[model samples]
Target: MRTSIVAVLYVGGWALFAWLGDSWWQLLVAVALAVVFTQLGFLAHDLGHRQVFRTRRPSDIAGLIIGNFGVGLGWGWWTTKHNRHHANPNHEDHDPDVSPAVIVWSEDQVARSSGLPRFISKYQAFWFFPLLTLEAWHLHIASFKALLQPTAKRRGLELTLLVTHFVLYFGLVFAVLPFGKALLFLAVHQGLFGIYLGCSFAPNHKGMPILTKEDELDFLRKQVLTSRNVHGGLLTDVALGQLNYQIEHHLFPNMPAPNLRRAQPIVERYCQEIGVDYLQTGLVTSYGQALRHLHEVGAALREPTREPTR
Candidate 1:
């Protein structure tokens, strides 16, 4: 079957579940939809990076429209930051999305984010949105910084695209469902989207050791050490968009999910040949690893020895 057909089937099936799931059985289906939306989030993220389709314009337009509700955040803004992420996965100065230091003091930053905003930036980094759209907020800030480059001015376009995306997208979701239902769904969907974003972005270099000032950036080494593969089950791959095989996706971002299954072996072989670590596990295992890493991360920052001297 064509990948497009498979995609439509998966998406269409979820729509059915979401619309008609009035019985107790719906909860089970809701769990399935949660997984599907996460995979969809990955595909949309892939599409945003032009790793899925050959032509980028249509994908960009679709990303602006279809992906807005889920991992939408800001399309134009995300593209810019995503490129930087791929380039410098863990560089503290370069990568704005994830910083190990965690203590930020920017004169330019608006009066030290506090209250809800501070909570979101610090603790909510993994789950700013149930639907992962607020990821655009992170992406937008990163993109705007990238836009500051004399060559590329993208901040304006990013905002315009996102605003247009909001009107059309929320318009449709609420148009079909009740206002209360829409907000509720938005809360739920965005929350789950946040879950999807958590698994999608965090596994790649988030909890891993930070790069040194002289750390060399090699392709396979970076993919192996910095990336991880989750879940081996077939069903998990379908719904999770091969996010379980994150190392493979990072190595070949253009490979589709189906091909990603095959690509894993090839990547594993190369990693083995080079004696690099290939972290592969079941879905729950990977999730636990990330959670544990986050805990370790929090503790590491809080250590009395590690704390900055007054």
Candidate 2:
């Protein structure tokens, strides 16, 4: 039902943009689409987790529809990458989310980086939010490359859906507005969409404890310690797509989105009983902590006299 509303809004936005003159209305439509698209992407994430269906096939189909067709992302690629992240949340080498060239999560990673990467790592905290403006475009290009790789599975279907998404997405924009307006529309849509997506994800695990390959911890402890929940009510729940319950979601990846809130107390109590560090904070606080952690990791790079171990 919720997905239906989001889908309607997404399609309607395109239609409204096409009919409306090239003015503020068009930009408004782009912003609306970006918000709608981000929500659809969240639903797609739920599908990838098999939370929307009892069986894997139906979930995959839904993911392909919402993720590939609607959100212009490769469902197969996302599923694979996301699963790996779930399997190893903050493991520096194992988690793809931590392998950012712009921001180094660990001092070791920062130390290993050289030249441009090292330079960026020196002040990545300041550049983080601004750099996310281009993340949507980066993900699109990355998805295409991942889907086109010889090692990628379901190449034919994935590539076909991705290509179809591109054709329809750009075709509608070009058809509705002039070339210049279309470019502006695209920029607005993708830029806001990228920031929206990044803001939703970064607070979940960004400032959490980083685990080394040699580290050994129980599953429950690892999940709870590495994940941070954002404190909020219904508004945050809807905006973050239930990802505010990050600790619970990571501990139970297959749990449905709506159930996360209900399960939160249970998870928190269990963590308490087990003496685990269940991190929860306000959204702004979480972002601040994430930024601070990034800066802390890069501090050694800025001061040559400082020990890298610090």
Q: Which candidate has the highest TM-score of all?
A: 2
Candidate 2 structure lDDT? 0.89
Local distance difference test scores for all models: 0.57, 0.89
In angstroms, give how far residue 120 of model 1 lies from its true place. Answer: 8.7
TM-score of 1: 0.68
Misplaced by over 4 Å in model 1 are 1-39, 68-71, 100-161, 168-182, 300-310
The residue-by-residue lDDT of candidate 2 on 1-310, one tens digit each, is 8788898898788778777966767988889999999999999999989898999899988899888888889989988999999999999889999985667898888768777777888898998888898999988999999988999988898889899999988988888788998899999999999999999999999988999978898888878889999988999999999998999999888999999999999989988997888889999999999999999998998897985662
RMSD of each: 6.1, 1.3
Q: Which predicted model would earn the best lDDT?
A: 2
Tens digit of per-residue lDDT, candidate 1, span 161-251: 5556557557755665667666655555555555566656655555554554577868767656766677658777655666667777777
Model 2 lDDT, residue 47, Cα: 91
